[model samples]
Structures are given as C-alpha cells and as structure tokens.
Target: MKIKVINKGHHALPEYQTELSAGLDLRAVLSESKVLAPLERVLVPTGLYIELPQGYEAQVRPRSGLAFKHGLSVLNAPGTIDADYRGEIGVLLVNLSNEQFEVKDGERVAQLVIAKHETVEWEPVETLSDTERGAGGYGSTGKK
Candidate 1:
C-alpha cells in the first residue's frame, strides 16, 4: 500500500521503527527551536504532504516516549487527515508538564497511522434495536 508523498524539507521521510509497527514517526520541521511553556500548545509542521487513497485516512498520534518522558503530547491525538486534503502535515503539540519544552528542528514529534475507514449511509429507522445494555452511556459497565 504505497502512497504518494512530497517532502518539502531536508528531513528524512517518516518511517516505522520496527517491521510490525503500525505508525510512522513524524518529525518537526522548525526553523528554530520553539519553547513551549507549561500548558502551552503549538502547531508544529512536518513539511510532509501525502495523497491517501479514497476510504483511507491518516491519523496523527502522540509518541508515547515524548508523552511519558517530557509530558508532551499531541493536542488532538489521532488528528485525522482526509484523503482529499493536499496541505502540509502539522502536529498540534501541547506541553502538560511544569517545565518548558523546546521543539527542535527535525525532532520526532508524533506518529502517523494510515487507517481504512468506512463511509456510512443514512439508514433512518423509527427506532434502534434493544439489547441488555441498550442506551447505556459511559461507565455503565462495572469497573471490575
């Protein structure tokens, strides 16, 4: 499933670390290091533009190492990139720690996962079928 991509910066293309890895590491393409204060968020560009096939979408997710070590995370975890979008990829990052975090050029910031999605059609019905846990909201099930 090779997709078309355009690299507009000097950084290497995003790649999976292992053979079975589902996501590719995305890097930040910054001119200079940007300091992010606690609770601050910024949009970091990747200088990558991709063309995904129809019914497939790209999801921008956080790197677990960055999130657990530096308290940095993708603001919109699993940010969706539609198949029709042709703009550069940007990662929305937020600092959740007390200390300021610096975003350096070509630093791995996020992970991108290509996913297949289904298009739903309107199946209007008078009422939905009922089950034992029908209409149950969040946490309706026991914690155990």
Candidate 2:
C-alpha cells in the first residue's frame, strides 16, 4: 500500500528497521533536547503528515526497548491516527521511571503501524447466540 506523506523535519522519513517489521519508527522533531521529569508526559511532534486511504488508520505505538530500558512509553498506547486527519503526527510520551529522560532531535521515540479496519453496521436483534464462555473476561480462565 502506498501513502502520501510530507516530512518537514531534518531526519529521513519513518521506515521499518527490517524486512519483516510491521511498524515504522517515528522520530522527534525538536530543535534541541527536551527533558521529561519522572512521571511527566508530553506531546512530541514528528513533523510528519500523512494521507491514508479510507478504512485504514495509523497506529502510534511505543518502542519496547525504550519502555524496558528507560521506562518511557506512549501515554496512549496504540494511539490512533484517523484516515481523515491531515495534521502533524505527535506522540504522547510518558516517563514512568524515577529519573528524567532527555529526548533529542531526530531521536526515535515511537513507531507507526498502518492498519486496515472495518466499520460495522447496527443490526437490531431480539436475542443473540450463546457460547460456553459467554462474555467471560479478565482472567475468567484459570491459569495453570
């Protein structure tokens, strides 16, 4: 799938790190370093704009290494970018550790995964079919 994008930052466009990667890394577009104190959250811009086709969305997610190493993660995990939005891509980053973290210009902070979705139509019904589990959730099945 092809997407139209505009990059105003100094770094190259977001791309997958490997051949089989599902997400593309997004970088911070800051002129200087920005500090995030412990438990602080901020919106970090990527200076990237994209036009996605209908029935598709761009999901912004956190990098695993950053989360495990620095306790930094996307405040809204898997943040959704609608197909109609045409604004700069910003990531909501939060510091979960007890120390401050510095975000530098063009630093890889988050990732973008383009996904295809479906919209469901409402169907009025009197009753629904039942299952053995039947709406059981949140550890309903005992762990072995």
Candidate 3:
C-alpha cells in the first residue's frame, strides 16, 4: 500500500518496511539539535504528513529499542490518527532517564501501524438482561 506523503520541513522522508515483520518508520525533523533533560518532554514532528486509507487508522507507537535503552516513551502510548486528518504527525516524547536525550535529524522517532476500525451504533432499550453480577462495582468477585 503506497501512501502519499507531503514533506513540510527540510528533513528526511518517512520510510516504510517492505516486509511484514517491520513497522512503518517515522523520521525526525528538527530545526536545531537539542537535548531533552530528564523527565522533559519534547514535541517531535515528522517532516511528512500522510493521508491514511478510509476505514483504517494509524497508531503511533514508541520504538522498542529507544524505550528500553534510553527510558524514553511516548506520552500517549498509542496515539490515534484518523484517516481524515491531514496534519503533520507530531509525537510527544518524554525522557524518563536522568540525562539529556538528543534527537538527531533522520532518526527513527516512532512507528505507525495501520489498522481497521469497527463502527459502533447506539440503540435505546426499555430493559436489559441481567448478568451474573449486575451493576457490580470494582472487585465484586471479592479480594483474597
């Protein structure tokens, strides 16, 4: 599936893995080299914006290697990108380690997974069937 990408900044193009074992790679577009201090958050923007296919959504996730080594992660674990949105894909990354983290241009910042969505509909009902534990609060089964 070939998606159209519009590069809004002077940065490297976003690359996609041709094989199934890999995820769509997003690159970095930085105006100047900077470091993210411990527990500091930074907004990393992708040079390219895209239009995903209808009925499908793009899930923005953190890179496993970066998270494991640098203690960095996405603020929102899995950010959702609607198919209709045509803005630059911005990722909010937080540095959990007690060190300054530098993000260089063309570095893989995140990965995108294309997935389908199910439409939901709501209907008004007069009465509903009861379950084993009707309207039970948290831990209704009992705590040991």
Go through the candidates in order and give the clash count of each: 0, 0, 0
> Which pairs in model 2 have colliding backbones?
none
Best by TM-score: 1
Per residue, candidate 3 scores C-alpha lDDT tens digits across 1-144 of 767778887766655666564567787888776588999998898866888888888888999889999988888979898999998898888899988899887778888888889877999899989997778889886644
Which runs of model 3 end up more than 4 angstroms from their true locations?
A: 9-12, 126-144
lDDT of 1 by residue, 1-144 (tens): 999999997899999999999999999998999999999999999999999999999999999999999999999888999999999999999999999999999899999999999999999899998897878789987644
**What is the C-alpha local distance difference test score of candidate 1?**
0.96
Runs of candidate 2 with Cα error greater than 4 angstroms are none
Per-candidate TM equals 0.97, 0.96, 0.80
Per-residue lDDT value at 51 in model 2: 99
RMSD of each predicted structure: 1.2, 1.3, 3.0
